[model samples]
Target: MTGAVATAPAARTGRAPAPRPVSPTARQMRRAGWWFLAVPLALFVVFMLLPMGMAAVISLTDYAIIGDTAWVGWQNYARIWDDAFFWTALRNTARYTLMYVPLGLVVALGTALLLNRSYRAVRLFRTLFYIPVVSSTVATATIWYWLLNPQKGLLNVALGWFGIDGPRWLYDSQWAMTAIVLMSVWAGFGTNMIIFLGGLQGVPGDLYEAARLDGANVWQQFRYVTLPSLTRTTFLVSTLLIIGAFQVFDQAYVLTKGGPGNSTVTMVYYIYNKGFGSLEMGYASALSFVLFLIILVFSLINARLNRPGDGGRVRRRRVPAAVPSAVAAR
Candidate 1:
């Protein structure tokens, strides 16, 4: 037994070494995680991050499609600052946003309110409104192009019935942006409508009942209850709409090519022409960065403005009417 004990100590002391310091399962899990992220990370690096970096580099150079390039050191941006066409496009985009965002909000909110009630065709109506949102922008543009055609178009034809000749829509510089705004609203409002519907449904039923009991009218209740409650959704929708409006491209591209005296020219279309048509890619990249900065700033502003109870970028809604009918009766 004493010999066995001494032998056991010797055996333990000489044990073949500690197990290899490794966790196969943990290693395998880490490998699997990388594998899982490989696709999106590769995609992001290639498509988004790489493009942005390349664009930034390009912006710094006086790069061109043909001939050896030189780094002009903000020359393109300096030129962009003085370019009248750039100003026109920027102005046009601002006007487009001013018109599009508010108009879109009104139509979407109104549609949502109309559809909020229980009705037989409510589901169908929801789907109907949603169809346009999913519809192809190119197809919508073509349809609109036809409808707004000066002579035989549906819009002008209808105007003739009322003894008023509608002005040439797409052909006229004055009416071109307006026409685009109308169609854009038609295409874009449905999504916001759905968002508003979800918000309205989420509003507390007891609040409505309380307002009713206090004798608040429909509009009053909407002002006091609905508008205030729907703030976050409205803010998001408005910001999105504003951003999209600033980046207006397809309609301007397809409809008028920014023509009829450059009326509907937008920043994106201008950049596109510079990059592809003129092959002034360096200048275009600069324009793109400027645009990106502008968008980021405004988005940040809108976000800041929409927060609760702070003197911020947006004006908060206030309504003063909430005493129940029962309370009044008493």
Candidate 2:
């Protein structure tokens, strides 16, 4: 009888179990989620992906606004190789990125460190620092235009009090880019400061206590504990700074208009001139692709360099013998 029962069950096992039915509410919620995502997805395809596809196609042809559109294959891209202005703009942008990213990082991180405490005054200071970020870029540039005036400007006037002559800021080719860098950093660092402040607040308090117990000084704690903990935040800030520096336009446009021998002409400004000013849409599109590639390369490098599990580039030093092993492990 047992053998017959087992045989009967084995015969029934060949048939699969019926699937469970999903509830009406579960199905409705899933449908609603897709419905919510549809608008953004449609917008993304219409605006971003469509324009990018159009730009890629446009880059392959000589599509001057009023002229006959003719396919030029890769000639437009080849022209970029010999374009002296393109190279100059790229070099100026690189210089700006080098100056702007490091300085901005330092200023933002410094301000964030200073304001990471809990106090009524700290809240006021954070708001004050963030004001420049929300201010209109054109308005900020206008203000800097007067402040950087070579002869009668506030910056030079203050220098005059010290008996040191301030260099011609926007007017001098040598200093035009520098002045723009200064303005860009001052106007933009507040956003990065806020980002860093968030990161600082997220760091585990236990790590600081561990470091303190291990006899770590403030600088040592910052260098080892804080620096390691904030690597991802630093990476994000630096990447944003690099992208922004390459595309800088309003400051250069409002302050210098890419003047003083094209010293402050960024890649985006040059592309704007080609596309709209000169109406070489094909060439401009090609330049834009090149700029995109450059940004992508730099961003990839930054990501690899700051990837988790690598403790960043902070120099390791011997901790005092009295320091605990826990601090050293960090």
Candidate 3:
């Protein structure tokens, strides 16, 4: 009778049992998660999305602070094409990007390589390298300003020890942009170095061991293993460099004021002059969108060039026949 009773439900009904009710603890935790997420989501909407919407609307209107606002409807964008100063600023910004991105990548990757070891003082050196990144941009520029003074600055004084005359960095148009590039690299490379370090650490120990077993030298192992592994990190760093290069304003304003004949005038600096200096908010907004588009295009190009599969395929083809089956498997 007991067995029949136990089997009666399975024989009489085929439907599955209902799900268990939510536990009070789990419900409370779920609510807490939403509450936690709401804070950053609210902040993002308020600070980022709202401002972007406002700028888009403002870009279509002539809204100088002291005058009646009028709808202009793409006139400002049209004007940008005819503005010679805009092109010059763009050219200067491009020149800075060209110099800064490669040098920044090299300095960052080199520093990461040097520090990617177990040592007592490694953390201290990393902290020292990162100090410039956390330091205020204006303060850093001010320091570099003093450092680049051709007459008595530390840089030129060191040059004097080597019997080489240093050029007037900030004061000379020819070297002003280069000086800014150097300062930018020094101030920013620490962040990229940390990123590279993270990427380096993620690389498999087995890959290096296999490379050594295959008679690969230091450079060959780096080329075949480390570089391939770090492709995404490189793309991330380079894209950031390009965007920051375009939006550069603080260092130029603090160090050179876009001068020694506007040689250091960047897109953001020019936009700042238009918006605040000349009270052309609409035009500046238009320029901002244009700069955003440029950044977008360049980032897409960088992503396409650094696609993981593309590099992986090439590397696979390049792997020497002498490499062992174990290395090939990795």
Candidate 4:
């Protein structure tokens, strides 16, 4: 019995096999993945995150490019309250946004609608329209600058044929901002038009057919069917236009230099002036944060306003159910 018990115990205590070592190929793949991750992580830390942190810290100090730095603790932000020029820049930017956004929407939507249909020339037209978008900002600005020349410009010359006197565009303080708005719309609408075109394609043909079967006119079909479908696209285009309008700098800088009594000075141009022209890096950083906050607020507002819903409440008529003859008889 003791011998049997010993043998049973030995059988139960049999050893398990050892684990296999990792292959060199698997180890090499793991090393390669680490290497792949290392560069981008290092770049994000060095360029993006580090710069943002430094800018935030700098915003609290008085760090003129050539002078001793002093911690001022929100004095720069306080100064923005009293800065009349800053307020003017803000107003100018607001005005540009107001003018640019609506006009851009109309033009982009119109062009998109016109080109949405199939035709032999459609591709050519799209390419031509998108050419301006691909052109550099400097190049477009240069072209517009020549076209807006007060006396010798093509615009006034064209107006002359119509027997209408044209006002000075870029040179006139009253019209400089207006001219800039026109140029901006023309140069930028192509991109949004493409977006609208894409949106138009996604709209179901069955909806339009149903609307027509219900005796809906073209305008009604568009109002009820097309508009609801393009809600997200419109939101996207409007948000982009708002952001671009606020950050307008290249056109104003290249065409007018915020000249003719600063009529065209935008918030971004103001920030650039403060940071580089005046060498007030700390103040510039503070102003930059203020603009950032404004953009963030507007973006949030846009998102809230355009949040998904049923588009509109379209009520369908409900029919009464028919009773069975046997039940009725009973």
Candidate 5:
């Protein structure tokens, strides 16, 4: 009877009720969710992933963007090792990084420390300081080109007033790269200043008071308290500055066009000249990958060098605890 009750319930219900179909609203919602995800996913695949894949594939070949592509696996990479221009560009980039990173850090940290007060005009000063950051790179380059002008520029004119002869800046190979570095630091320090300011704010005020109570002087307090607190911020700013210094191209393009003697031909400028001016896309791609490896190695080294508790490369020694005065007397 129970089996019959279970078995015949559908039969007894006559023609078993048809399964309920999904509501139009529910189906529409499902479709909407899919469409919403589909657009960005499709864009990511098409724009980002596809281009990277194409670049990687092309880097192995000899494709000039106009003719047949020949697969010459690793040949482009081998050529990069032998390219003198590549080495020169790498050296210039390294020199720029060395000059820019330290100068940028010092200026940014100094400005941030100066503006870390509670005065009313601080905000106004910060806005003025950061105005250069917001200014277009091209505009800044053009203005610097005028300022560094060999004859009529304001910089040399100011130096002339002091009875000092200023060297030709952008026109001279020796000074062209230095001029670019100075201009970059001026236009770029504001962003790092803001970052350092944020880090300064995060430091505990109580630590300063404690240091003062310990009879620590201003320099001692700064060395022990402020610097220790700023390690992470310094690492962040240095990494960013290094990356930017390596990729510098726009200023070179606008001011010197990588001349007076390729003094300002950075890695990116080299890549750009190879890719566009020389029309060697495959070789250009290979150069780009080399630069990518160089950047990755430096970045990894920077990270390792600045990792927490590394003391920024100085090892901290554990001093033995002092013996009791009574024990010493015995």
Candidate 6:
């Protein structure tokens, strides 16, 4: 009986024996994949995660560039609440964002609408518009300075034709922010216009055809079909414009120099002054964290407003958010 049991396969088919069962190779391969990810994981930890942790630590201390860093445990944050300069900078940035973003959206959308039609030189026109975005900010600022100069400016000369008094665009505190707003809109509208143009193209033509068949006019079709479809693109463009307006530095740095009595001073310029100019790295670091928090809050508000169910949502982006809930959508 024992011999029969051991030789059952041999007895049945005259085969020597069956080979031992092997483990699933796919599971082993999956296990191998864990090790394969180790390098990239390590790099993310070292480069991204490590730096953020260090910044958070530095934000808690009172370290200057040349002196010892002392931990006062939220004192920096407390100080920020009472800082008038910080408040002014924040207010200025908010005003700048409001002025530029709405005007930019309107102008970009209008331009995009015009360019959506057939044009022979559409490519050239598009390039001409986008040239400023890729050009150096310093160069653009310098050109703007000459164009908006108080006495010898081309704009004021044009104003002379209308017999209307023009403001000293770059010199007067009242007009300084206004001039910056105009320059920002001109420089930035092109990018958003291009984006909107691309979005308009993505809108299917069949909808327009169907609307036309239903006796829909251009305005009606756009109001019903076009706007609904372009919601996502509009949201994306608005968020970008808002963020850019908030973070404005280069133009203010080169043109107004945060002046006409700090009327054009943005939060970033304020932070830069605190960090490098005054050598208060710790205070600057705290300010940097506060700026980060502000950005984070705005970003959250943007995303929340733009989400699918939120009525006025924009397109979801490929870039990750800077704060929590960046993972929630996933």
lDDT of 2 at 299: 89
Q: Which of the two, 1 or 3, has more TM-score?
A: 3
Better of 2 and 4 by TM-score: 2
lDDT of 2 by residue, 27-104 (tens): 999999999999999999999999999999999999999969999999999999999999999999999899998999
The local lDDT score (0 to 100) that residue 50 gets in candidate 5 is 96
Candidate 3 per-residue C-alpha lDDT over 87-155 given as tens digits, one digit per residue, 9 for 90 to 100: 999999999989988999999999999999999799999999999999999889989989998899999
CA shift at 222, candidate 3, in angstroms? Answer: 0.4
What's the C-alpha lDDT at position 193 in model 4?
96
Q: List residue ranges in candidate 1 displaced over 4 A.
A: 1-41, 308-330
What's the lDDT for candidate 6?
0.81
lDDT of 1 at 242: 79
Q: Give the TM-score (vs. native) of candidate 2.
A: 0.91
Off by over 4 Å in 6: 1-48, 308-330
> What global local distance difference test value does model 2 have?
0.90
Report, for every candidate in turn, its global Cα lDDT versus the true structure.
Answer: 0.85, 0.90, 0.90, 0.87, 0.87, 0.81
Please provide, for model 6 over 1-330, each residue's C-alpha lDDT reduced to its tens digit, 9 standing for 90 to 100: 998797886788887666776678966887899988998999999998898787678778877768677887788889999999999999999988889888999999998988787777877888888888888888888888988987888888789889977789888988999899888888878989989998899987877776676566677567656776777788889888878888899889999999998899999999889888997777777887788778778877876766635443223463134312322121
TM-score of 5: 0.81
> How many pairs of residues collide in model 4?
0
Please tell me which model should have the higher lDDT, number 2 or number 5.
Answer: 2
Model 6, residue 151: distance off in Å is 1.1
Q: Candidate 1's residue-wise lDDT over 1-330, tens digit each?
A: 998886796687886645776699989999999999999999999999999999999998978889889988888889888998899889999889889988999999999999998988998999999998899999999999999999999999999999999999998888999999999999888999999899889887877787786678888677666776787788878888978988889989988889889999899999999999999999999999999988888888888877634321223223222445432222
Give the Å error, residue 138, model 3.
2.1
Model 2, runs deviating above 4 Å: 1-19, 309-324
Candidate 4: clashing pairs of residues: none
TM-score of each: 0.82, 0.91, 0.91, 0.81, 0.81, 0.79
RMSD of 1: 8.3
